[model samples]
Target: MALMTKLKHVDLLADGSLRYRRRIPLVAQEAVGKKVFQQRLQSKEGADLIKEYAEIESLYEQMVAQRLVRARKEALWGNTPRETFKAAKVSSESVWEGVRGLDRDDPEDRHLVAASLKDEGVKKLILNPNKTEPKPTLKDALKLYRKERVKDDAAMETRITRVWSEVEEAIGDLPLDELKRENARKVRDHMISVEKYGGGNRSAATVKRMLNVVKAVVSFGLVEFDLGDKTNPFIGLKVDDQGDREDTKRLPLPDDLTERLRASLRGDLAHIMTILDETGARVGEIVGLEGADLFLDHETPYIHIRPNTTRRLKTDSSNRMVPLTDAAQKSFKAALKEAETGGPIWPQYSRPRGSDSASAALMKNLRKLTKDRKFTIHSLRHRFKDRCRDVGMPKNIQDQLLGHSSVDVGERVYGSPEAKLRLAAQWIEKLT
Candidate 1:
């Protein structure tokens, strides 16, 4: 009797050759254990009969070639039959062993190397597999960061780009995630020690700016990892005069100095500076004025201070009217006389012609006249607030004249039409 009972024929392709196979049933463990087994045959005649019908080892070379073409088509469309075959052979040494024995210079063998790595699960090997490397080529980082910020906030995006550029220049080959606090501190210290400015050594301000970049990236990383309540390493880090950086030094110039500075200035620069000193309007609002902003004919001459470039106002409160002083009214009248168009009242002080020309000819001219003075052109704005206080201008009226929103009274009840009229009237009376 034969214990070997042959089952249905199966087919397989090997090296562009096809061959048939047959299975003999056995217990699973024994099948796994045995390379070959002895079988008790029914008779010698039966054994011989089974061998005769087995077709020896017939190879279908043509069928195997056709199957290769079909498999290639499937692979191109992402079915990837070849990869599946390699994956299915993970436990089998002979399949990959044969792959290794191929010509070392062959491109196909290089692909086989990649497949080998994939088969071993290379993705599970890294500490921060999902996190991107800082060493991503400059081109790649730009594309990724740009794609991330679609809102086109130019100021914010510029800062991010600038910081990345600094980091890239400092460390060329290292990835961003590999950066440590020690290295970041080194960079900060280097910037503080080595960097130069218009003054002496680069101030703590410059150091703080560079550290801010490192902190931003780390914070972004922490958020990505869902880490809770992590403090940034850059937070407590300090350079020289660190406490002094917090002091904004916002105070008014003395009355005598303010008057001298005003008289020393000429043209739009003089007028603009004068108006800023009188009204406490921001430089942006003063420079961005249009003829329509001034209402000189009204009972109280006033100008609406809006925060806008070419498009629209920045905020609702920024759209309110501010009373103009006598000096401001005189400047506005002079600006109107010189205006070629009604768009911007102060036309001479319009947008820049060029970087060098604008800075040297325009800004430098003003700086030359005020060089001996203690006050900045911006200090005039501070003086306006101080003068308003000196003259016993009500806080609410002063805030209204400065086009500032009423924080004390709250928005709901402040800056009514009556309040605006009263403030504007008081401003006119004082100016007159």
Candidate 2:
């Protein structure tokens, strides 16, 4: 029951008669004491009544302060009904009996849920009503992972291969559910550590890329096989590339150095690098380029790159004709002369059985050729971008040249073969 108190005071009338008044406390329990106190004050025992009333008010104030403290404590720490009484140590078990007695619509259900989580020794199990571990295998997860990649709008097959390779090396045998954060971190650390021994210190960015793939696979598992709510373990893992080995860094090659490298290179590698340099085409694009795609008509020769048709261009603007420079034109002429009927312009760039091993071989050769210029063959593409920037090419044209039109063009119009060829000629002049 609620408690209250009363105040007693006396007043003198104009006719010289004494009268009394009482103030009542707010609660029903205190109202009883207050009523009796007021009765005594009305009987003219004013001083005694006043003293009684003051005591009652003091008691009421104490009860109010204590009740407020209890309510505040209950609101903060009390989540479940059991926890509420447990914290408050309230003897009135009935207070928490009726759901309606407490605010049933209070938005503290999350806390109540957390408080009621099952403690399963070492591993606290929440919502494990079935009392069994979710049996999602890593192999199954990986299968789904690969299938999804195949259907990806962007077919990241190479990236998928790389991710699978690491998973195989580190925790391939483990189940998906068993591949927890600590194990993942250990594998990543091991990869970083042994990198120098295997070849050289691998870039953290490269390691992170591999980890991110694994992380993505885990996320897929969550959706494919409903794992209970847990924070994404890979979200906050730091992968710093700032201090990675100089040779491992993937920055653009200098324009002057690239030209020198092209001139110095002997056979197909040099020709391929030059093509990448002149056209700003990606390694994938260059590998897939063909003599049929190149047309030597209409005042200037142009290449018609189309996805799933002439060649897989990967973008609409990647189909652009980069008007061949003298160097590029001569290089292609020689390449065409050297090739079989169905062979590509730079046939060496084609997947020559086990593309991974071939790619690694190419990087090693590039490393030696650049005389520790310290970058992969892929950096030639980066050099192209840097060269474009250095020559003040518009961002749109630059993006087009790099085959990056994966979305709607913002303000900048997509270029045609003629426009691109013209742009390429200007860009080549800047390089020279």
Candidate 3:
């Protein structure tokens, strides 16, 4: 014979009979002394056992409800002394008279009366039944969501602040429930338009990212605040094609411009640009580097790119050791000499502001050498990749050197880190 499945909150006894087992609510337990509330049901069979369990469960709820009622009543009337009641201008007799007016036969009425007595706001609503509950505004919801969910996440917190700021500017503080698809579309249009919230016209990707944050905020509010039955207005929203712009596909700088930029750049900013040009590391990765991350003494000199308290790598693949070229070694050595006592290699830009600060400093000097807006600090990474491709380096080897995850499963899963380092070192040496 097949064994019967156990029901929730119902346990099987030693004799194979089901028992109704549930812990009483803490409030009820406190009001009425803690005692065994569980009982063995009469039925032993599956269907009959479930039926009996339901009936027992209902009785258990009623028992707890009665205890709660008593506790609330005591809190409201019995606990308050006559002197305290007089101070509040509330008479003991008047409170009892109001209680007596509530229908004793109706459980709902009793619950409402007890709830109103406990809460001043609820009591006011009870007295004036026509008064409506205030719905939380989008700004309120976003603030609560940030506190509960994204407070610890710097990137998420920044994105939420930016997205919500835009939404607030376009449409004033509206109720979260009142935000519909039409409002979302309007926000999207405003973001894409040249009318700056802060930055100039937002690209499609930016608009999409902002909308995604809005959706996440709405979704978080629904679940976090018990508003799941409500609709998420930001969901399934789309940005127009006109908003879409391709990512920067900057070409390698001409030899003269590159040389001029290298000569014009100075100090820590100069070293940062040199490192980017030589290693193809992201600006954030280079700026966030610590002294310990440099392994120049090792047989193969490399920089370990990893997450720190200040910032994180773009992806897991970004957490890798990049072997340094001759030019990169020189830059790294210069950077190490100026390293903080025990902190990051570039301490000047080590805090949360590192990446932006470093980029701005570098760009300011770079603009003097080259008029081309396309020749950004990031273009060095592109140039490195282009050089690797030009030299006939294997795609997997290129991916490893650049901290990009390989699309090929064989290379991703089976390729050894040592093998990758060897190939990458050889290819990077060729670029020098």
Candidate 4:
């Protein structure tokens, strides 16, 4: 089966079929488990046999490359006996002979090869055919950040992802270890100078917040990767004297405006308004609801506020159960009739910016009802808090029901969920 004009390491089997054969290096034999790696060449043609030889040879080369890198790392760690694992014995020919002719037809393969080249540069000449990569950039750390910190409207996701976009623009995706204090300052100045809305520059407050997000992301990475010795460039920078003001916060909706708005709501808007009035859930949280999040068959009906694939809750504390009032019960019953089990109750807004879309629609309706900007859709949440306070609901109970920040209402003291449901239903009835 061997052609006389053919490649090295090609052999004829006893059955007269062609085969490719090679010896596995001693260091990698433990991982691969054989002295020689041989595979039958299915093709009997001359050109095809040579092609199969290269393909088989490349696989062997890849294994050798990985074993050599690991052996080098082990020697450096002083974990392996030096003479038994000599990386210096690795021949020049073994480093990515296959990679040189790697299929450029594959997009991911080409991209990874290029990206690896950018990191190592001219000083480190070899491509890692083993597919090992070194160190994460701020962009890389963003992936880790997303796993740990999910927030409203994907707030952590939005703000943090934006930080990486800015990082990529300014610094070319510098590794986390190389991110110096100067680099953070560069990003801050870049943010300040950019015109986010028309000709108007990004506000000092906006810049400060971006820096805070950057700090949070970097701090998260340092702790997670155990790179505490690395300097965090985003921390304690002097971008300010203009701090947040409490007066700018959304006010409770006036009673007359609430009554007028209640009268105006119709169709899907009516259902959303009724749920907001009864439960004080965020507009986004309501629109992003899946049918499973609602419990109607129980003795007391309630809406569970939590995160989903498309929507992110502001914090873990945002997840709580709100017992429905009579109006909410009617509205949700209608939604359940139309919605699929475990599917979105309001499919229109169950997406990446679904809440923002819902906000625009709500605000457009609110603008027609009132000229005042102070009484926005979010005032419903404030009004709910005020209503609870006026009805003399225990502060802890109010906090627990509304998902406001409170140290404890004592989960043990709250007892079973049925007890909590009965307790919440009693208080929510007063809001009606």
Name the best candidate (by TM-score).
Answer: 3
Q: Give the true-structure RMSD of model 3.
A: 25.8
Q: Order of all candidates by lDDT, from best down to worst? A: 3, 4, 2, 1
Predicted structure 3, TM vs. truth: 0.64
Give model 2's TM-score versus the native structure: 0.56
lDDT of 4 by residue, 84-203 (tens): 122322421243344666554466655655565433332132333333335656655655666667543344554455555565566665678888889888888888767542122345
Give the winner by lDDT. 3
lDDT per residue for candidate 1 within 148-177, as digits (tens), equals 642455334444544554554555323334
Per-residue lDDT of candidate 2, residues 113-133 (tens digit): 335434322112222222343
Distance from true position, residue 62, model 3, in Å? 63
Please give, for residues 1-432, the per-residue lDDT of candidate 3 as tens digits: 022254556677788776677788776788867754788878766555544654565456546655655564344222122223333334323443567656644657646664647545444434444444466666656767767887688655545654665686677667667777888788877777643221224456667877888788778877766778888878888776542333433567666776788776556666888898888888999988887787888778888898876578888888887899888899888878867644788765565434765676566657767656556766788888888888898988888878899899888888677777776788778887
What value does the lDDT take at residue 306 in candidate 3? 87
Clashes of each: 6, 2, 0, 0
Flag regions of model 3 displaced more than 4 Å.
Answer: 1-133, 193-202, 240-249, 368-373
Score every model by TM-score. Answer: 0.52, 0.56, 0.64, 0.57
- Summed over model 1, clashes come to 6
Off by over 4 Å in 1: 1-105, 108-150, 154-174, 182-218, 221-232, 235-251, 297-299, 310-319, 337-342, 345-374, 403-406, 410-412, 415-418
Would you list the clashing residue pairs of candidate 4? none
